[model samples]
Every structure is written in C-alpha cells, then in structure tokens.
Target chain A: MTKQVVILGGGTGGTLGANRLRRELPDDVHLTVVDQDDSHVYQPGLLFVPFGLAHPEDIVRSRRRQLHSGIDYRQESIDHVDLETQTVHLADGSTLAYDLLIVATGAVLTPEETPGLDGPGWMEKVFTFYSPEGAAALEGALASFREGRLVVNVVDMPIKCPVAPLEFCFLADWYFRERKVRADIDLVYVTPLDGAFTKPVASQRLAGLLQEKDIELVTEFNTGEVDGEAGRLVGYDEREVPFDLGVVIPLHSGADYVGRSPGLGDDLNFVPVDEHTLQSKAAPNVFAIGDATNVPASKAGSVTHFEGEVLVENVKRFLAGEDLDASYDGHANCFIETGFHKALLIDFNYETEPLPGHFPASVGMPLLKESRMNHLGKLMFQWFYWHALLPGRDIPGIGADMPSAGKQTETAH
Target chain B: MPTRTIAGATVDVNDEGFFTEPEQWNEDIATELAAESGIDELTPDHWKVLEFMRSEYFEKGTGPTVRVLGKTSGVTVKELYQLFPKGPAKMAAKIAGIPKPRGCI
Candidate 1:
C-alpha cells in the first residue's frame, strides 16, 4: 500500500518539506504538493524591491520547477481539509486522501481587518512591500517622495520577517542619503511591540541603531485605523501619527483553509502545534511548520528552514510507528541589514535570547554586531535561498539546534 | 526575576512587574496590580477581560494579543481600550497576572 503524503502550501516550507520527504521516504510513499498559485517567491527579496535594489522577475520562479521529479505539484485553491477522514478538498471539486498531512500554508496579510487601511490612499500614499505588486508599487511611491514624514508602521505582531520593517527604515535612510534628501525626511517606525523588537538585548541594540539613523521609534502602538486619505495612523488608544507616506505591514494570519478545517487552527487561523515537535495539537497525524503554526518563533524563512529538518524527521518517525524527535530547539538566525553596507547577524532560540559574539563558531559571522561582511552575506542569501534552501540541501555546519559556541552569555544580561 | 509584595502577598515578578509564576496570582493581587496601573477599581467588565486573559495564559502558556482578546474575549476593542486604558494587551496581562504579551520574533 502506497502511503499518501499531502503537503499544503507550496511556499518555502511545503517545497522544502516535499523535496526532503521524497529523498527520505521510500518509493512506497507518494507525495503531493498543493498550492493556489504556481509562483514560488523569494519573500526576503521583497524587502529590497522598494529600494530598487532587486527586481520582481528576478525573485520569482515556477513552484513546480522547485519540486523533485517524482513529487506531484497541484495548483488549485484549497477549499478545506476533512481532518476526520484525513482528506484535503480542492476548490476544483477533487479530494486528496493522505496518510500524513503537512500544513505549510504560511501567513497572509489582512489589510482589510484594519479600518480605512485598504481605503482611499492605498497604493498611492499608503503602500505595503510585503507582496511583489505592493513592493513594485511602493518603488514608484518612494522614488517620487523627496520630503515629509515617511512612517513605516507594523499594524500588529507575528508579522512575517519582523525585522523587515526596521530594515526598510535603515535602507530608506541610506536611499534618501544617496539622493541627498535624507535630512529633509522624517523617518518613523511605528510598531505594536513595546520596543524596537521583541528580544531585549537585540531590541536595545536595534533601538540604538534607529536613534543613530534619526528614525523615530513609536512603541506599543496598536493600529486601530489607517486614515489614509488624511495621512494619519490612529492607534487603538487614540494616539495618532500623521504621515505623508506610510509603509505598513498589515495584520497577518494563517492560511484561510486552516480556519475552515475544524479544530486545526487558532483564532488567527495559525495551526497550534507542539513547540518542540511541530506536531499539530489538533491531531497526531497532522503537522505544521513556518508562519502557519502558532509556535512562538519568528515568522521568518530561517525559522522555516530550521523547522524543515525536524519536521521531515518526525514525519518519517511517525510513519515507522516510532517515537517522534522533539529536538527542534526553536533555532532561528537572521541577518539584520543596516544601512551603509553593514548588517548584524543574530542567532537564538526559545530559551535564550540573541547574544553578541560569533555565530556557528568563534570564527563565524559576528553576532549582533554591524559589519560589511554580514551585509554581503545578506546580499548573497538570495542565491543561497533559491539554489540551496528550497531544494532541501543542508548548509553543512548549520543544523536544527542553535549553537552556543561563541555567543557571549554574560553580555546578554 | 524579582519578588514584590502586592496586596500583602509576596509574589515573583519580572522587571516590568509582570508575574513570573502565574500560579502565585490571585484576585487580590489582580486588584492591587490594577490599581498600580491607575485603574482605581476593577469592574465586572474589567474582570471579564482579566479572567479571559488568565484562562488563556494557563491553557496556551501565553496571554492573548489584544486582537485575539478583542475578537474572542467577549470584549470589543473599543471597550478593551476603555477598560485597560493605554495598552490593552500589556496592561490587562499585567493586571491579570500573566507575562507581558510579546511579539513572537
């Protein structure tokens, strides 16, 4: 009997998971990857689009091309999953019954959830760089603007690539400086978090960078309304931050199909999975990874990449009727792109916050310190992401667990 | 971690005064914590939000964000701001004896 394995959402997690499973699982196991569209976007590249650093066509490829030869790639909208029957129903009136289900449907931006956000000034003055179209549109908006306050507002938490907004601010400062209009523009970063970021040590360091770049940091701002026509972001607490142009990361939630499937997701439609195992709490046979899960990890590609190793291993264990591996330590590493050809790299997990030192080893990339080498690493990652990461090939030294070799534990305090 | 005496009971708290151990929390502690945030009194409406936060924190190991609470906690976002004042998620979680609602990143 062939074991049918259905991987939902052919984005970063699904593509990697399907490819890895094909290599690991025997010929007896059949793999099917489902997604609404055929485009597999290099999401991290979207950040550079508005700055005119990268083009749209360069970052996108066919989803089917990324999968292994034997794997099935289905381009159809997901209607819902019948968890009881272990089946996925497609919008095209078809069903996929699976022995194991992997929910890799990542988060989606919900701009309409906030009042007046998708209204009047949308794409004209208020723009988002999360989507390729939005990023392309913002490029025009950003290129034209030479003065006035440019507000980069994160509507709420759990957004994909949480550091991207801050990176945008840094890049904007550099871009405007290149144009010699940086001194004329007021840069403000509005976020719902109490600081510049979630983790303390990193937040302090990032807050310092923002200060050095003259970007105003507005903390604890839960956006209630975006009066785009009026050029104002009204907070739930009635605090208003006026802006001439707004770069907003709208509220994010999991895939819609997860919500339609009963008991599979949370209030935000993110699948509730065991933090360690990536096994869905709703059912033993169902698993999730990346931004789709309600796990307290950054909704970043790095986290998804780390999770793929553990997730594939667990799926194999589950199929063999063996104990699952709970070795996923929430390891996440990110390269923070600061302006002026310098970036900071930070590595941490569930138990420990990001600390300053070298990453992977003492001779590795410097952690939490700005360097030109880290910036180059960021630029080179687009190639690494498409060629290596999406194909499920391991990067040799990096693994599922965070390494503590060169991290300064004392400096974290 | 640090210890603070609130409402005549010694409880463990973090630097921001959020209860490190949620088991040490009680109604009296909640009352005193609420007062600290300038909510002179805890109304039935306030307790409604606080109770929801407590139950959610215990079940999920983290308090709900304001958006989640507003959508599912039987309280409107407008009412949440009215009840908890400046910051609904952080302020309510603090008074409700839970860790601060933090960004996942």
Candidate 2:
C-alpha cells in the first residue's frame, strides 16, 4: 500500500519539509506540495528592500524550483481540508487524498483589519515593508523625504519576524544619515509591547539602541485606528502618535484557508499544535509548522529551520509507529540590524532568553552585542538561505539544542 | 568584563576573549590572540584574510560579507573555516584587531 503525503504552502516550511521527507521515505511514499503561487520569497530580504539594499527581483525565486525532483509540486489555491476524510480540496473543485498532511501556510498580513489603514494613503504615504510591493513603494516615499515625523508601528503581537520593526527604525536612521538629514527627522517606534522587544534582556539593549539613535519608543500602544489622512495613529486607550510618514506592520493571522477547515485552527486561524512535536492537537495525522502553528516561539525563518529538524525526525518516528521525540526546545536565532553599520545576534530557545554568549561555542559571533561582523553575517544569510537552508542541508555544528558552553549566563537574568 | 594580558598590557574583553577596543591592536597582541584562538601562528594564508578584512573595515567602516570575503580574499570559505573554525567573520576580526563584525544570529 502506498501512502501519500500532502503539504500545504510551498513556502519555507513546506518546501524544506517536502525535500527532507523525500530523502527520508521510500519512493513509494508519494510526496506532494501545494501553494497558492509559484513565487517563494526570501522574506528576510524584504527588510533591505525599503533601504535600497536589495531589489525585489533578487529575493523572489520560483517555489516549484525549490522542491526536489521526486516531489510533486501543485500550483493551486487550497480551498479547505476535510479532516475526517484525510483530503484537501482546491478552489478549482479538484480534490486529493492523503495519508498524512503538513500545514505550513504561514501567516497573512491583514492591513484592512485596522480601520483607515488600507482605506486611504495605503501604498502611498503609509506602507509596510513585509511585502515586496510595500517595500518598493516605501523606497520611493523615503527617497523624497528630507525631514518629518516618521513613525514605525506594530498593530499587534505574534507578527512574523518580531524584530523587524526595530530593524526598520535602525535602518531608517542609517538611511537618513546617509542622506545627511538624520538630525532633522523625528523618528518614533510604536509597539503593543511595553518595551522595545518581546524578551526582557534583548528589549533593554534594543531600547537603549532606540534611545541612542534618537528614536522615541512608544510602548503598550494598542492601535485602534490608523488615521492615515490625518497622519495620526490612535491607540485603543486614546493615546496617539502623530506621523508624516508611517511604516506600519499590520495585524497578522494564519492563512484564510484555515477558517474553512473547522477544528483545525484557533480564532486567529493558527493550528494548535504540541509546541514541541508540531503534531496538531485536533488530529494526529496532521502537523503544522512555521507561522501556521500557534507555537510560543518567534515566528521567524530560523524557527522554521530549527523546527524542520525536529519535525522531520518525529514524522519518521510517527510513521514507524514509534514513540515520538518530545525534544524540540524552541531553538531560534535572529540577526538584529542596528544602525551605523552594525548588527546583533541572539540565540535562545523555549526555556532560555537571549543570553550573551559566543554562539556554537566560544569561537562564533558575540551575543547580545552590536558589531559590523553581525551585519556581514546578516547579508551572508540571504546567500545561506537560498543555497543551504532551503535545501534542508544540516548547518554544521548548529543544532536544535540551546548551548550553554560559551554563554555568559549572567545576562540571561 | 574580563581582562587579559596581551602584548604585555592588560586589555578589556568580553567573557569570550573578544577585544572590547580594536584600536589597541598591535602585531604582538594579534599573535598572542591568534594563539589563544587555537592558531599556532598567523600563517601567510591567515594574514591574507586578515589583511583584506582590515582594509575593507578601514574603508567601509564595516567588514564585508563572508561571501564577499571569500570572493575577494583568495582564501575560499572552506579554507576560512579550516583557518578559523566555527565562524570566520568574528573570529578573524577579533584576531585581526578590527571592530567586531556582525551578522546572522
């Protein structure tokens, strides 16, 4: 009997998961990947687009090309999943049966969820760098600007790449400085969190960087409205941050298809999974990863990379009817780009916060400290992403475990 | 902050022995630092990477990406790891006496 594996969303998680499983399982176990479109984006590059550091054409590659030769790639919009029947229905009225399903549709940015955000001034005066179109538009908008209040706001939490809003402000400071108009600009960062970042240790360091860069930090701001025409962002509590140009990261939720599949997702449409095993709580045959699952980890590329390793191993074990490995510790790492030609790297997992340490060992890049080397590593990652990470190749020495060998545990407090 | 005796003078470094002040770098200090980082001595090949990284940092105010470093340094990425195990950018810069190079967490 031949078993079929159907994966949703040929983005980072789906593509890598398909390639990895293809290599693991026998040729008889057919693997198929479905996506809304063929374009697979190197999402981290979106941050550099608005800063003129990258081009949209350079970051996007065909998702079909990303998968391996043996894997079947379907270019179709997913209509819904019939959990009981173990099948997926496409918008074209076509259906496919599967013995196992992998959901990796990730999150969708809902700009319209915020009143007046998508109504007027969208892709005009107000923008988001999360998408290529938004980033390219912002590049032009930022070019003509000499001086004014430029505010970067987050509508809510659990947005993909949580550190990106902070990165945007840092890059903006550099952008204006290069134009030699930094001193004339009033920069502000508005977030729902009470500090600069989610984690306490990193937030203190990031808050200091925001302060040093002369960017005002607005915290606990539950945005109620984006009065783009009036150039003001109103929080639910009635506090407002005025802006001439606003780059907003809108409210993010899981894919719309999740809504069509009952018992598969929560109110926000994220599949509830065992944060460690990635097994959907609602169904044992279904698994979720990346932004598709409501995992208490930062929704970033690195999290996908770490989870991919564990998910692959556990998927193999699940098929063999063996006890699963409950060992995924939520390991995630990210490069925080600070202005002035420097960046910072932080590696932590579910249990530990971002600690100051030399990652991998005492030989790697410094932790929780800004440096030009970290900036180079950030640029180099785009290359690593396409050539290494997406290929499901194991990164040497780096693993899912949060190492304490070279870490200075003092800062973790 | 931890202090180490390099070039017969006490210098400040983080817990991992990365120099806090790049300006205090000297040849004698680099040799000692290299030895501590597991290199017996700065080979002519090692100097090839270190020198290029130095000029790039001094010119651009930051080190070039490792991909650029591999393309320009005559030393390949594989050789870079052999020379500086684990991480080439920060390890080489720390030993080369330049400001800490940053990227990918």
Candidate with best lDDT: 1
Q: What is the Cα-based TM-score of model 2?
A: 0.79
Q: What is the DockQ of each candidate?
A: 0.73, 0.01
Residue-level lDDT of model 1, residues A312-344, one tens digit each, is 999999999999999888889999999899999
Each model's lDDT comes to 0.92, 0.86
lDDT of 2 by residue, A55-159 (tens): 999999999998889999889999999999998999999998998899999999999877899978888889999999999999999998898999999887678
DockQ of prediction 1: 0.73
Residue lDDT tens for model 1, B1-105: 799898899999899888889889999989888888899999999999999999999888889888999889999998899999878888899998888765446
Q: What is the TM-score of chain A in candidate 2?
A: 0.99
RMSD of each: 1.4, 19.6
lDDT of 2 by residue, B1-105 (tens): 777888897887876676777666788888988998889979998888888888887874666545456557888765776787745777798888776653222
Chain B fold agreement for model 2, TM-score: 0.82
What is the alpha-carbon lDDT for the whole of candidate 1?
A: 0.92
